[model samples]
Target: MLQNLSSPSLQPSSASPSPFTHHSSQNYSHAKPWPLQKRPLTRLSCASSGPKRKMVPQSEKLEAEQLVRSIMWNMNGKEPVLKTLNKYVRVVRTEHCFLLFEELGKNDKWLQCLEVFRWMQKQRWYVADNGVYSKLISVMGKKGQIRMAMWLFSEMRNSGCRPDTSVYNALITAHLHSQDKAKALGKALGYFEKMKGIEWCKPNTVTYNILLRAFAQARNVEQVDALFKDLHESIVSPDIYTYNGLMDAYGKNGMIREMESVLSRMKSNQCKPDIITFNLLIDSYGKKQEFDKMEQVFKSLLRSKEKPTLATFNSMIINYGKARLREKAENIFQKMKNMGYTPSFITCESLIMMYGLCDCVSRARDIFDGMVQSGKEMKVSTLNAMLDVYCMNGLPMEADMLFKSAKGLGIVPNSSTYKLLYKAYTKANMKELLQNLLEHMDRDGIVPNKRFFLEALGAFQSLPAGMETATATTVVGSPLGRSKT
Candidate 1:
């Protein structure tokens, strides 16, 4: 017979129910803790002095219940509640009230999440669970709070809750999301083995897939191949997710032949490709400019009776735009509308990019205007595409306007965006715009690439008054040099 996991000795037929699982739904009874007697809300920390805030009381269970209801009313999403709760939380100690904290943690409220975690520790009803700690760890990971995530993982163990496979997976994924790839990969591998060490908490297919993705992202092709061999050697079977990860990695690394072989292996394994699989293949072919192969994959996806998703159309349009295949890309856009799939932010971004690439500035502007009219949020890529199109067609003023619009809309321009605007000003010899954009990039912490440096050098060379060239290459073994912008 399968044993009840919560309690081993309590048999289903003959034994009394365990107390842990016996919390009655009707009896909401608890002796009030001393903290609940004073204020209804506890104030933990105060930052900007605007108004006095209250924390949910620790003692009054009913008060905590009402407070939760009020907090829930104030919260439309995690961000708002997190901001409000950060100033408040010290008074509330009820387990039910911890829902606010957990939600905040799940939603990337890193600091508030820690405050709640600490608050839970001080509460009498706080029974540490692997689930709670794992959640906190995942939140911290997502928010780039790696140190905090590790601390919570260790705290879970110290609190007598054993880390399970799920907890390890969370940790691995967190590290993987960090900006430092080498360190993240090393950390993920460490957790992978730690999960494997426990007899009951062995690494599963999901665990391997996460690691496989990490290795692939790091471009460790040798590790990817070894993982496949190890999977075949072990009892674990590779699934669709595994194949998709490998194909994506191979495609990204421009290893088209290896990607095809992996597709063949997927077929031999009888793992029917899903939408994501088809999207990967199409995107890969498109990136390689193998449009014929890309079209073939698109046709196969359509014929397979699996409906094409937004990602499918977005990939096609973006690749076609990049290749300057304007007509065919537009046809796909029309077909998507005909198929009843509404254009998303990505779809609009692709179309703007496509028209921009084809030098159809008016058409790109039309799409941008439509996006605004429909109240669709504009992405930085869309703004960048528009800016690039304007600059390419000798419309610097229009480019400047779009750049200002991006700033006004609170959209920070990336390196590519700044690069386009910089080139525009360079062509027109507009020193102010040119200097300003470089400063903007610096302010935004976006590192200018070789492309930016090269463009600036070209601008300096194109100066009318004098050429920035070496006056003499050899003069008594002293080579001449010129300064570039």
Candidate 2:
């Protein structure tokens, strides 16, 4: 047995507070200031009018993105963009300016993109890089700005940034974007041959993909086969993207056997079919009205781990609708909803058009109404779908009503909308509505071109002789009617 140590002598002194109590009641007022340390000296100028900007530690990439966004937001025109950029070119890093140039290029502002490129060239810190030129060339090509893209290639060479496979690929793609397909293909092939001769500029997988896609789109089967053979022989292994590109091009051209062969080859290569591969197969089969094949692919997609995307459902719905399988289309739509996939504008538009085509105008209207009630942004296509349904169902009055309320719905009717409405009004002999539409077109600066006249004449030609005379009599008094008479 041990005696309890409760002696007074073992207790803390009352005059001195315990260590914990002392810390808890710290005397901040009497605390000594930390000793000042000498900071590294930076050069200062008294001549500066404003206080120097504090160097905030941030990622160069993030800063670059912010600078680009700032310029874009303040951009009024090319001149303004140049002026604004001039102020920042010195302050921002070189890599940031490159990003800015890419952003402008992506927006289809090719002239502004060129200005930035030229501005970058003039900068003291600017070093020629293949990436910058390749990106610019790709963008210019997408917009069919072939001349600018070619000039950029020349500029890149002059800047000592030797053109690589990527640069050549972009050049080939730009040429393919031109309206003269045959000429463009010839130029692309010329570049391909040129690329093959140079060891440093040897064509890569992207190079092969670009050429194969262009040739396939042109429906040049001989060229596609030759390119495919060349790709196989090349050291660079073709990826899924390469096969997908060829498959899409072939599918669009109605080469079902060729597309399937590509799929089989993809499987043999041990390249697992991704979502895009299945989507293309489904869409192609649907277009061909080969429902069994389409269903087989859909089931295969489901069996695999690859999740069905919005595109997958859209293709299924569109195809089912095309085949007049209304119940099947609706079932797919319901399934899409159950899978927690939100309906997009394209989805709504497809359903509306499908229902309208199947002579279910009420169901189409219901879908359109649901979209509106759900606060979804109604696109011009959605409006067109509903208007088309009304027109197709011989309900021109309803179509006219929707057209009149287009402004309220934030829809700026394009020529297609006008054409649909005109056809309906003309057929129904709604002279008042037709005249109003012509006036609206004039007001909107939508010139009634030859296409409009030809379509209107064709519509009238389909009517009985008596009805045609009545329509002419109704139109003759109106402004456009007088010109026609």
lDDT of each: 0.66, 0.72
Q: TM-score of each candidate? A: 0.69, 0.79
lDDT of 2 by residue, 1-485 (tens): 00111122211112322211111112100101111111223422111111133353457446657777888876754447668878776675545555665667667677887777777668665555566677678778888999988998898777656677767877888888899999999998899999899987888777787788778878888888898889889898877667777888888889988887777676656565556677788888888989888878777666665677787888888788878899989999999999999988888888988898788999999998898788766788889989989998899989988888888877889988888888888887787888898888768866666667677767886686688777766556556654432
- In terms of lDDT, model 2 sits at 0.72
Candidate 1's residue-wise lDDT over 210-309, tens digit each? Answer: 7776687677878878878877876688876677777887788888887887777776676666666777888899999999888887776666645677
TM-score of 2: 0.79
Worst 10 residues of 2 by lDDT: 27-36
- For residue 357, what is the lDDT in candidate 1? 82
lDDT of 1: 0.66
